[model samples]
Target: MKNVGVDGSTTLKVYESRGGYVAARKALAMDTNAVVEEVKKANLRGRGGAGFPAGVKWGFLPKDRTTTLLCVNADESEPPTFCNRVLMEHDPHQLIEGTIIAAYATRSQVAYIYMRGEFHEQFHVLQKAIDEAYEAGYLGKKVLGTDYALECYIHRGAGAYVCGEETGLIESLEGKRGQPRIKPPFPAIEGLFRRPTVVNNVETLSCLPHIMERGADWFTGIGPPHSAGPKLFCVSGPVNKPGCYEAAMDITVRELIERDDMGGGMLSGRKVKAVFPGGLSMGVLTVDELDMKMDFEDPRNYSLLGLGTAAAVVVDDATDIRLVLRNVARFYGTESCGQCTQCREGTSWMQRIAQRIESGAGRMEDLDLLLETARNMGMMPGLSICGLSDGATYPIETIVKKFRPELEAAIRSQPAGQVEAVLQAAN
Candidate 1:
C-alpha cells in the first residue's frame, strides 16, 4: 500500500529507486531451507481465503522431488473482493519480486501466475513487470546473478470461479476442466502435471519479499501470534468510502466498517443490518456481532469458515437479507462445476428456495429446509471434492439462522406482486 497511487510505481526503474528486489537478491544468497524456516517463524497465512500457513504448506512438499512448481493464484473470484487487483495494478513489482523469492525458496524450477480472465488491466501491468524482472536477471536462468534458475509465466484463467481452488487451477493449467480433485495426494504431492506444486495467492506471495527483507520476528510481532502480519481488507456496499485497505489483523469488523480512514461508516448514516465479514463464503455477521476480529481464528468462533479473503461487504438496514441469500445462492449455483452431485444440486436447490422465499411463495417449513440443505451441502464426508459448495453453505446458513425473523417476515408478507416494488425501491 505504500507504493500505491505513487507515479510510476508499477515501473521497474521507479521500484528500483525505492530499493525494490533487495529482498529477492538477499533471498537468492541464502539457503532455501533457511528461507522457508524464516517464513515459518513469521506466521504468514495464505490470503486466498484458506488462511493456511504458507511456510507449513511449502514444507509439505516431498524432499526427494526434483521438479517443483510454484503457482500464484491471481484469480480473485470471491464475490465483491478485488483487493488482490489493487496490489497487481498499483504495485505489481512487489508481487513479482515476491514470486521470484518464493519460487526460489520452494525450489521450483517453474512458476505460473494463474490470473482471472476479467483482470485485463492487471494482467497487462503484471506481465510488464515480469518482463522487466526477466531483463534485470531477477527472473529466468541465474536469478539475480545466482545459480537459482526460475521461469515465471502468466497463465490466464477462463473466468471459472472454482479455479480459485488450487487443484481446480492446476487442472485448468493442465488444459483440463477447471475442477478440484480429492485430497491425500494434495498439490504438495501430486500437482500440476502430477509433480510437486505450491499454490499461494498474490497477497501471500507478496509478503515473501518483506519477510526476506525484514526478519521473520518483525512480522510475528504485528498481530495475533497464530495469524500475525499485515492484512489487506476491502470494505464495500454502501459505505461512504468503500475501498481496499491494509492494516494489521488486529482490526475488528466494526472498525473496518466505521473507521473514518477505512469504510467511513455506512452510506446515508444508515445502521448496519448485517455484514459478509469474510466475503460471501465465510458467513454473515449480524449487527450485534460486528465486534468480531478480522483475524483468521476469530471468524471460526462465530461459525464462519475462517477469515476468508478478509473482504467485508456491509449490509445496511435498507437492504433485505433475503436478497443477499438469493444472490449468493444463485452465484454458487451458477459457478459450481457440477463435478459433485451434492454440490451441483445443493447449490441449485438453495438458490431456488431462496428465490421462492424472496418472491413471497415460501412456506414456514421452507426456512428449516433451507437450513438443513445448507448444513449438509459441501461438508459431507468424502463427498465434496473441494470447499466450493461449503462456500455456498456458510452465507446461506448464517443468514437464515442469525436473521430468521427478517427472512420469515419477508416470506409471510411478500405476496409475489410486492416483490417488484421491493426490487424497485432497492434500485
Candidate 2:
C-alpha cells in the first residue's frame, strides 16, 4: 500500500511495469473452466464477511445463461473494515485485473464495480484506473487482441450499510433502495437486472491476479488448510498502531494485536481486555481467548459468528464492555433497513436496553430480556430478511452473556430511585 503516495501509482504504465495486467491477459488466454478450476483448487473464500468460497460461488452460475454479470463489491461500509478500501486506493489495477479475470472465468460480458458512494476519493482513483485500462486495450471490446470482450463500469452506492449485503448491493445497482431481496433465487440465479450475477468483494477479487500468476498450489500453501492464502485484517481501537496488516490466515488473534509490526500492542500502557477477531459482526473474544486462531472455523470454536471481514477491533482493559455493547447496538439500530419487523423492532429494543444499562439504569431482569430478544432475532430464517439483525445481535448477546457479572454489579450500584426513573421514562 505504501507504493501509493502523493507521487501516484494509479496509471497503467506504473502497473504494467510492476508485472500487472499479465494475469488478466493470461487468464483471458486460458479456457474459462480452467481459470475457475484453478480458483476452486486454491480454495479462495470470500473476505466480505460470509467466507463463501469464491470459486464455488462462480460455479453456481447456470451454464445455460447467456448474460452472466460480475459485480465487484467495493462497498466497504461495515465498521472498522477499511481493508477493501485500502486495497482499492493503493492497488486499483490489481482489483481491475482481478475483475477482468473473474469476469472471464464467469463468462460475464459486463462487470460493475458497486462502490460505496462515500468513498469519493477511491471512486475517482478507480475511475482514473478504469479509463487507463480501456485506453490501453485492457478493457472494452476484444481485450488484449483476443476475441473475448468485456465492458466494466462503476456504480456508486448511496452509503447504505445494507448495501454491503450482496443482494442489497444488486438492488442499489439496479437503481432501487438498498434492501436485501429474499433468497432461494440467489444472486447467482437472479441478481442485477434479473440476470445471473456473481457478487464478490474487492479483496476477494484482488487475490485473483496473484493466484493466477503463482498457480493454485502456491496460493493454497500460504496458510493452514481450509483457510489458506494471505488475508488483510484491519486492526483498530485502542492499539498503539492500528491499521491494515496482511498476514497468513493461521496468525492467532493475539499475534495480530500484540505484534510490534502489526497493531503494536494496546495504547495508554493498558492490558488487552477483549478483541473482535473479525469485524463487528463477529462476537468479541476475551483476552484469555487471544490465542485463538483467526481462521474461518476458529471463530466458530470461540462461539462467534464466522470470521466476518477479519477486521480485528481491539479494546483495552480501561474500556467498559457495556459501552461497547451500547455503541454496537446503536450502529445496528441506525443501519437497520426496517424491511423486517424482527430486525427493526428487535434492534431498537436492543439499543434501548443497552443504552439503559450503559446509563446505569439497567434492571436485574434486563439482562435476561436482552438475551431473550437476541434469541428471538437469531440469524435463523423466518426471523429476519438478512444477516444485519443477526450481526446486531452478536455484540449485545455475547457481551451480556460473557460479562454478566460486571453488568450486574453496575446495575446493583445504581440508586433505586434512579432505576425507577429509568423505568418510568420507558413507560
Candidate 3:
C-alpha cells in the first residue's frame, strides 16, 4: 500500500523502473516447496477477514494434484473495505507480479482474478497491466523465459457480496448462482470445475511480491511473531482523515482512529459513540475500549469476531445505536442468499426485530430474541453454509449486548401501553 502512489504511472514500464517483477523472477528460480516454505516462515496471515495463514492454506493442496487453479479474490464487497481496490487501481503491476509468483508457488498453470463488477476503472487499470505483462513475457506460455507457464485473466463478478466467500466466488466464476458450497470438500481439495484451486485475496497475493523481495525473516520481523508484516487499514466515518493507511499490527484501535497520520481524530467535536474495529461484521467497540490493539488475536480478547478487513467504521456519539444496528442487520438480511434455513430466517428475524426496536415498538425480550436468533445461524452452530450469517450477527449481538441500557431506555420512553406491554412481556 505504501507503494500505491510511488510511481507516476500504472504501466509495467514504470513499475519495472521501481524494481517490480524482480520478485517474480526470484520466486520462479526457487523450487516450489522452497517458495512455499519461505511464505510459511513469514507467517503472513491473510489480510482478508479470516486471518488464516496464507502459506498454510497453500500447503493444504494435495501433493499428487496435477491440475491446479489459482483464484485471486478481487471482489472487495465487504463494506468499508477498499484497500484491495486501491492496490489494483493505483499499482496494478504489483498485484500482477505477486499473482505470477503465487501461481508459480502453487504450481498452477492458470489463474483467475475474480474482481467485483462495479470496479470499472480498476478493471481497465489491471487489464492494462496484464497486457503489459504479456508483452514483456512476464506471463503466458513461458514466464520470463522459465519453463513454468501461467495464464492470468480478470473475471469480473456481478457484484454479489456472497462471492467474497471462496466457494461462492467459485460458483460465480463457474457461471452458476453465487451461493456458498458446503465445506469438507474445501476449495483446496475439490474446487473450480472440481480441480484443486487456490483462492487468495488480492491484498494477500499482493504481499507475495514483497515477501519474495525481502526474505521471510525480514517480513516476519516487522510485526508480532505470529502475525507479521505491514497491513493496510481502512478508516472511515466521521474522522478527519478517513482513508487507508499502512502500518504493522502494533497500531491500536485508538491510534487508527485518532493518530494524525491515520484517521486524524473525529470530525470536529464529534465524540465517538462506538467504532467497528474490524469493519461492521467484527462487532462494535465502545469508546472506552478504543485503546485495544487492532491485531488478529487482540480483537478476540476484546470479544470482536476477528481483525476482519481492518476497515474501521466510526459511529459518532450523537448517532442512535438502534439505527446503527438496524442498518447493519438490513445489509446482511438483504445480502443473504436464502439458502440455509438458519441464515434465511435468522437474518430476517434479527432485521425485523432491529427495525422494530429502532421504530419504537420492540418488546424488551426482543433483545434476547436477536441474540438467540443469531446463535443458530452461523458456522458456529454448524447450520449455515458460510460466514454471511455470522457477519450479520456480530454487530447486532454486540450492539444489543454492549448498549443494552440505551435500548432499554428507548423501550421505556415509549407510550404507556408499550411500556406496560414490555414490562408484562419481561415478567
TM-score of each: 0.96, 0.97, 0.96
Superposed model 1: Cα runs more than 4 Å off: 416-427
lDDT of 3 by residue, 1-427 (tens): 3467666668877888888888899999999999999999989899888999999999999999999999999999988899998898888988988899889999998999999999999999999889989998989999999998899999999868999999999999999999999997999999999999999998899899999999998898887876699999999999999988999888898999899999999998999999998888899999889988878888888778899999999999889988998999998888899899888888887887888788777778888898888776774757678998888888888898889999989878877677456546657
lDDT of 2 by residue, 1-427 (tens): 2234434567778888888888888898899999999999999999899999999999999989999999999999888889988888878998999999999999999999999989989989899999998998889998888988999999998879999999999989989899999996999999989999999999999999999999999989999989989899889988899999988989999899889999998898999887888888788898789999988898888889889999988888888778988998999889999999998999999998889889988889999999999888866866677899889888778888888888888888888798889778878
Candidate 3 deviant stretches above 4 angstroms: 379-381, 416-427
Candidate 1 per-residue lDDT, tens place, 1-427, comes to 3488889999999998988999998998899999999999898899999889999999999999999999999999998898899999989999988898889889999999999999998999999999999998888888889888999899999889999999999999999999898887999999998999999999998888888898898898888888888989999998999999999998999999999999999899899999998889999999989999999889989989889999999988988787888898899989999999889999999998888777666667878998899877866667688999888888888888999998778777756556556556656
- Clashes (N, CA, C under 3 Å) per candidate: 0, 0, 0
Worst 10 residues of 2 by lDDT: 1-10
- The 0-to-1 C-alpha lDDT of every candidate, in the order given, reads 0.90, 0.89, 0.89
Candidate 2 lDDT (Cα, 0 to 1): 0.89
lDDT, model 3: 0.89
**Top candidate (lDDT):** 1
The pairs that clash in candidate 1 are none
- Model 2, position 41, has a per-residue lDDT of 97
